[model samples]
Target: MRKVDLLDELRSEIGVVSDKCADQVNDLYQFVCESLQKKMPGYQWVSIYLVQDYAFVLRHDEGERILPQSIPFGEGLISVAAARGSMVRERLSGRVEVYMPFYRGHHLIGVLVVIAKRANVIDEEDVSLFMELASLFETKVEKYNS
Candidate 1:
């Protein structure tokens, strides 16, 4: 398969984002994570975490290893995006990680994290596009939850 660009892949699925009901949102998370892992070059894993009780709970993931059930909502590799409400690009060990937050209006609800198997597979531009996509998804979420 041809290497896919993150922005292009997300744009191609513009119409695929469906209802943001509780159950449907979970399916959407799984779908988005699976799609990213399959199509995005160097993206070895993808996960979406929802926050509750001041922590992040891994709701969906597409990868080999299972992550912890929950993590404290603060400074950390996975919590950076949700903590800051912005995209964070960091190089840990040798892998590049991009963390994007899912916010509804001003309240943060979750985080989308893409882990790259290779160094520098994703960059600032990719993060920007991902943020926009997250915003679109957030709109649906906010509409339903409010």
Candidate 2:
């Protein structure tokens, strides 16, 4: 399916699911990881890292051991996004590293990391969709935590 179609399906799924908070978040995270991995063939790993106080905790992941369970705010991709509060997409020889921030109002909630097997695979459209999905995840998590 196309990216738009995939996103639509995910949004529909999100709409129908019961509000179980943690379960929903996990489902959403998995959905995003799977969808990106499938749609972007170059993407080898997709993960969400949530910020808790001074740390970025790995909430979920797809693909190989591309991320640690947790890292400091200024250590890796997670910290790059957290510190800048913006999306960072980098192209390496055979991998593409992307970091999208999850923010609610002015507070930064977390970061989503996408690792592609090839460089420059993450485009503008992908970044846009990732941001939107991350926002949705952040909103739900914030509500659940409140």
Highest-scoring model, lDDT: 2
Query: Can you write out model 1's per-residue Cα lDDT over 1-146, one digit (the tens) per residue?
Result: 33345467566674355543344667677778877777776787888888888888888888754357788877477676776778888888798878788787888888888888877788666677678768867976876677
In candidate 1, which residue ranges exceed 4 Å CA deviation? 1-6, 19-23
Name model 2 segments beyond 4 Å from true: 1-23
How accurate locally, in lDDT, is each candidate? 0.74, 0.75
TM-score per candidate, in order?
Answer: 0.83, 0.79
State in Å the error of residue 131, model 1: 1.0
The local distance difference test score of model 2 is 0.75
Error (Å) of candidate 1 at residue 116 is: 0.1
Per-residue lDDT, model 1, residue 128, is 70
Which residue pairs in candidate 1 have backbone atoms (N, alpha carbon, C) closer than 3 angstroms, thus clashing?
none
**Once model 2 is optimally superposed onto the true structure by TM-score, how far is the C-alpha of residue 132 displaced, in angstroms?**
0.9
